[model samples]
Target: MSFEVGQKVAGKVTGITHFGAFVSLPDNKTGLIHISEISDSYIKDINTVLTVGQEVEVKVLTIAADGKISLSLRQANEQAKPETTGRPKPAFNKENDRNYNKQPQSDQAPRFNKSSAAPSRSSYTPNQNNSPKKEGDFDSLMSGFLKDSEDRLSSLRRNTEGKRGGRGGRRS
Candidate 1:
């Protein structure tokens, strides 16, 4: 069978080295499952999960242009499980899996009174009684912001007005 990236296939562990394990793929092709790809968790010893001549299912993660193959055991197991079909039925643990695909709707009832949790339309109407307040509306916001900016600039200027201003007070 032809192997494609992301396709899971059975392979035989032909040899094991300290670095990784060599697997003979289904079509007489060989691939390496790196020590890091041997499992989902940290692997202190590759022998714990793999043995010479052991048959295992693995996913093809990459096939280099020069024909080098990279496989992953974690991906194969994840793909082996069955997925759900779209049809409402009794509650099942599988429902949890669906959560990964979509976010749940809000559980709280919608507020209709327009007093609590509802945006006050009057606050953003621009020209009507509920228009938003711009800085010029109060004539103070712009002044405050400008004053703060001026104060910071003045402080910075005063700090740099000394002989220790450039290059951290260096003579150069």
Candidate 2:
């Protein structure tokens, strides 16, 4: 009934809660399998994956000073699987391969120039050369942000005024 960290043990899932599942261990002690420790992928609901009285192999993650046990189903499953060597093959893309070997256009320079002074905030103009400006460019970005803010404020004001029936206080 002695349990050490990283030891794989089988247990019966006795109960399940929103946060975790309670597993009855060999020593009559129960350990908790946290929602995060249940799987490598996202789990919206634990009941979808586990049910009462179901047998599961869990790795002993930790034993707190107070004797609380933390277990991981994911780690136990991983330990049971054999390890593979070498990196996974990169996905092939014809366009990416062509672009990777191509040289940059001679007319185009690096995006930033160390010699040139930074443009002043006031002097900045967007879409000057008819080329599409990046969304992060200052002028267009500020204008879009201001417009969105104004729209939200106006919506809030209209909703409040409608609720109040255009009056400031209750009529006597």
Candidate 3:
């Protein structure tokens, strides 16, 4: 018998593999229940969840052109869950509101407040040099670096210049 998508059917577990479990359906057709669809929670081992000859109810997910069926055990259980109420929830009253419409104190800057478990920026000072940096200091810092670099390069060139000609002093 042909099964429609979303159809829940009763079957028996015929085989189990690392990837999935095969269920023998009504028409002697076997469908594969992927490892991910086995349970809501993670299942490290399919053997722990299912065994050979175990009865199971599965929801039909898709039917391939080559007569392959994709089934879901989780979706089958989901179908049996009772729906939530259609009635609307009551509106919240200002008095009953948790915050009570009170504005946060200016002192308590929640945006800057991080979890106590983590190190706060205010507590963790990145200034390892113990120097106070200002916005106008970038140009001065860059110029100082350039001067230092030029001095090093000039000294390197002077030291290497005498060694360039030969391994030993040339014969006259």
Q: Say which prediction, candidate 1 or candidate 2, comes out ahead on lDDT.
A: 2
**TM-score for all models, in order of appearance:** 0.47, 0.56, 0.53
lDDT by residue (32-111, candidate 3, tens digit) is 99999999999999999999999999999999999999999999987788897789997989888879878999888687
On TM-score, the leading prediction is 2
lDDT of 3: 0.87
Model 3 spans > 4 angstroms off: 84-93, 105-172
RMSD of each: 11.6, 11.9, 12.3
Instruction: Please list the C-alpha lDDT of all candidates, in the order they appear.
Output: 0.79, 0.88, 0.87
**Ten-residue segment with the worst summed lDDT in candidate 1?**
122-131
- Backbone clashes for every candidate come to 1, 0, 0
Q: Model 2: which ten-residue window has the lowest total lDDT?
A: 125-134
lDDT of 1 by residue, 87-146 (tens): 878666765776766754689565565566566665444323433555465557667557
- Angstrom error of the Cα, residue 16, model 3: value is 1.7
In candidate 1, position 106 carries an lDDT of: 84
Q: State which candidate has the highest lDDT.
A: 2
